[model samples]
Target: MGQSAIGTKMITQIGILVHDIEAVSEAYANFFGVDKPAWNWTDTPDKAQTEFLGEPSQARAKLAFIDMDSLQLELIEPDFHPSTWRNYLEEHGEGPHHIAFVIEGMKEKIAIMESKGMKLQQKGEYTGGRYAYFDSIPQLKVLVELLENDK
Candidate 1:
């Protein structure tokens, strides 16, 4: 078999959306035999209303950032209004939500995905990094995200 041209990039993070934050976080902590993540709460700003696709409301999410070697595992629980994470929990229950790949040429890659009929779910910047969400593998029920750090 010939090698493919697509080179493997570093997986910076994996995000999991869970209904119960404590339970899920504990499970991962025990499984990985690592320290529990430091918790933080994030609120969507009212001024940033244009970012939300559905309603004009501020959503709250509890994030636990766990460091595992060079990669970070983020476990998120949507506490306020329903978001993509909440919707995923409602539809598929608690599980892996998205795989984040850190790479260069984000805009070019997004354009390529769009040209290939992949739908763009969301795109924005957070904490000096840019992220773009794409539709899941139809029948597989998963999301793929391309993350680029400006730092």
Candidate 2:
């Protein structure tokens, strides 16, 4: 399998980390037309499995979503846990946290990326899927999130 075998697609969502959920959610709603009940937010799911730096880990974040036709915008406030959201905020001072790509054959994709020198920084799960943060910042200048979902 060559490099292009991964079959990467368009970004499905843009994830951002903010210091204040309500303030940032309201601002995004006002400026970008994020809709009501955007508060369908939640704490880090209990059943969701996660890992960081090759060790089993628990991570938490306050999450809200804004639908924008084909693309979704995610607002994340790092909860008091071990998460990339927390790391990004502490290291980069808050902004776009990650850009996501919904992928097929996710395990293979991850292996390929790693073979090409990318680092697997974090792993997280939600309702129907799991996701990974690839440390592509050195080359792409931003984190690339790959999601494998049942949707």
Candidate 3:
């Protein structure tokens, strides 16, 4: 097969949205035969940096990242808020939510996805990174998360 419209983004995360991050992360650890994630945190979008479909949104989630050889496995639990995770859970239940890519050329990547007719579903920034989710459900069967992290 040829290349996709989204281009060759280096995937960095396999993201899963669950009802309970701690419970599911532990389950994933056992299933994958690895220890639980060493990196874990919570994100509550600061209103100033968060947008859902270009509008402001109050989204919160608990996140955990398990270190793999090449890529990281990400676990997320939707807090009681308006967010992609909450929507996914309500519509599809807990499961794989999105695949994430960490890229350096953030603007270029976003433009590529936009050129492909993908809509920005969610976007926010954290300490060392910015993340955006694109509406790629029909083609990829899930949303695509673009991550640009300095750390």
TM-score of each: 0.76, 0.88, 0.86
Task: List runs of model 1 lying over 4 Å from the truth.
Answer: 1-8, 46-57, 80-82, 139-141
Superposed by TM-score, candidate 1 places the C-alpha of residue 111 at a distance from the truth, in angstroms, of: 1.4
Task: For residues 1-151, write the lDDT of model 2, one tens digit per residue.
Answer: 4444457658889998889888888888889764643554443456666777777666777788888989888888876667677888998887898888888777898898798678999886778888889898888888888989886
What tens digits encode model 1's per-residue C-alpha lDDT throughout 2-115?
Answer: 531113456778888877778878888899897666677763454224134434445557889888888888898976564566667788887888877776777887777677
What is the number of residue pairs that collide in model 3? 0
| Worst 10-residue lDDT window, candidate 1 | 46-55
Greater TM-score among 2 and 3 belongs to: 2
Residue 47 lDDT in candidate 2: 65
Candidate with maximal TM-score: 2
Question: Lowest-scoring 10 consecutive residues by lDDT in candidate 3?
Answer: 39-48
Q: Pick the lDDT winner.
A: 3
Q: How would you encode candidate 3's per-residue C-alpha lDDT over 1-151 as one tens digit per residue?
A: 8875445557778888888777888887998898877545555556327777788887777788888888888888877777777888899988889998777677788888888877888888887888889989977778999888865
Against the unseen true structure, what C-alpha lDDT does each candidate score? 0.69, 0.79, 0.79
Model 2 residue pairs with clashes: none
Looking at model 3, the pairs that clash are none
